[model samples]
Target: MSNKTPTLSVTIRTGRGKGAARRARNEGLVPAVVYGHGTDPQHLLLPKLELNTILRNYGLNAVIDLDIEGTSQLVLARQVDVHPLRDYVEHIDFLVIRRGEKVVVDIPVLVEGTPMGGTLTVQEASSVEVEAEAMHIPESIIVDVENAEAGTLVTAGDLNIPSGVTLVTNPEYAIVAVNEAKSAAATEDEIEGDAEGDATEAADE
Candidate 1:
């Protein structure tokens, strides 16, 4: 909701190979790569402690104000390679970014509220792909199904794009839909229970 952008600072590590990464990890640094915008992929190292702290607060999209050996660059998170077995930053990829540059990214959609006593089904026809300015990407889109009736459906074309955001997903794509909850049919056990209740009431008369 806030317009403030998040940033982190890191350093350049020219070392390569498993041993080099292990040493960097031991020294509290993360192995990373900087690529995109037709530039050569630069292998770098980031401060593990500082990056972890920022990610813990800002999530995956945390921007970096990388100070690689005192040269500063603005970048947006692109990919994060992790160790499947442990809590370590195996590698990271950052996309070089400049103001007013449009970048495509997928944003999650959250649906709130349910049709009364009915099953609210999520039929996500498409994930939100938008081309937004590098510095102005939105976090998540909020969709309200609050008290929406059965048979009602919401589609991408129906979505209201936030200011400065452009939709890349197909307009005809379905986002979600509401339907009637399934009703339970009378079973043998239910019939027996009703008979028992009737018999008990009759006997009490």
Candidate 2:
């Protein structure tokens, strides 16, 4: 895993109309808002092409070094709004954070290895609610599923936490479990039924 970070330089924009926003996008910049630490909300323009590349690989918690008109700040990605079908970004919200500050963020849970005999079903895909420092937030939480027997279950409390991190979710939430798969014959029956229905419609046509 690489520990490289992305650096971005932004310029503050005072215009607040649709025309002003369109001009920024035409020039390959994105309209963004920055707010935190009792300061007023600052309208910012970021280089969209570069910021998109960084966010694509790093997810929502990516950190950025932002420069607004020669002023530098360390910030964390907070929220983003994008077009439903277009590739353009509609807006982005960045939270300015200081080092050593305790920031609460959700970390994704990754299951390692298959359950014993490949007979397990993931009851829940993700576990929510966690707290960590602004700079020490983990990329993800790993849950070991190696050789787990039937009737075995893993919960959010079973997660291993690194230093400077804490779990804030319910301790009893089921994250993964072992179960018997539905018989292949049962699946085939459903498929066959659907096929027959399709054929009947074609005949009617």
Candidate 3:
């Protein structure tokens, strides 16, 4: 994660309900709510393009400094709702957070390097849950499979987690595995074997 923090200036939304939210979108703004730390939910309007840019640069767990009508509040982009057909951001839920606070988030897993010849690397898990400081959350975890032999299993415990980030997922959770790639003939044989097994089972019955 980069040390730089993204800032967004927004205004408190006055209107309510679906009508207001639709109007905000028509004006290129996304309706959002901020709530956390036992505070009442505050409705706000965010720039659609700016919010998308921040998420693109920092990922879903981006920590943002929201300038709400001249007051700055530290927050996390906790949830986002998007239009299923139009593919635009509809609403967002921001969670208020403080500096040095521990937050649990699911970080994406990235595979690096290439496995040994004739073996293919298969990702078993896409992301893992971890707890880290609000400002120091890692964007993703990397697993190196360079020259890895077939049958080598990479578990969550094997991930290269940065210091200060505690893994919340089970240590035994499988992440990736190196396996021998199957050839066309081998695939055909498996299909034939299944068919024969079905016939034998029917005869026995």
Candidate 4:
């Protein structure tokens, strides 16, 4: 949950095309691009292990400082492309940001406390969009369901956001809801009964 920006070492990349990208991967480097802020896109190469470690520790919304041959740039991870089956980072798209700048990002929604009255709490949205300072983004928005009764609904408007953050999601959008828990055994029995009745009708026909 730390807002501290991580600094990564990157190098300018000159090669292009699929063969070049494959060669970079074979050498344990990830191809990435830095863009935005009225600047031309810069193709770069990053260490595979270091990039993965930062992403794993800080999550996708992490704002990081890239040290490119001694020059530093503050950027946010906008999009990440990963290898389909190998779970490795293939490419990343970064957006440049400045201090005090507000950016829209999707923040994870966390549920706290269980609903009352033997009800089951179901999450409708796992994340919500918000606008916050690029360097001060909140880790996640928490939804407190303590003592919530069956049929209780929590909407985007009900979320408690930190000061200086603005909710971009629709206020009426449902985030979570409480409903009575259904008996799994009973449901299984009903399905079995329906199947037997269908079989009997087919035999009679």
Candidate 2: the clashing residue pairs are: none
TM-score of each: 0.77, 0.80, 0.92, 0.88
Residue 98 CA displacement from its true place in model 3, Å: 0.9
Q: On a 0 to 1 TM-score scale, where does candidate 2 land against the true structure?
A: 0.80
Greater-lDDT candidate between 2 and 4? 4
Ranking by TM-score: 3, 4, 2, 1
**Top candidate, metric TM-score:** 3
- Misplaced by over 4 Å in model 3 are 199-205
- For model 3, residues 1-205, the per-residue Cα lDDT tens digits are 7677899999999999999888899999999999999999999999989989999999889999999989999999888887899888899999999998999999999999999998989999999999999999999998989999999999999888899999999999999999998988999999999999999999999
Over 92-137, each residue of candidate 1 has an lDDT whose tens digit, in order, gives 8899987678888776777877566646576675358888887777
Cα error, residue 175 of model 2, in Å, equals: 2.1
Q: Spell out the clash pairs found in candidate 3.
A: none
Error of 1 at 59 (Å): 3.6
How far in Å is the alpha carbon of 58 misplaced in model 4?
Answer: 1.9
Model 2, residue 129: C-alpha shift (Å)? 2.2
Q: Please say which candidate is ahead in TM-score: 1 or 4.
A: 4
Error in Å for residue 136 of model 1: 0.7
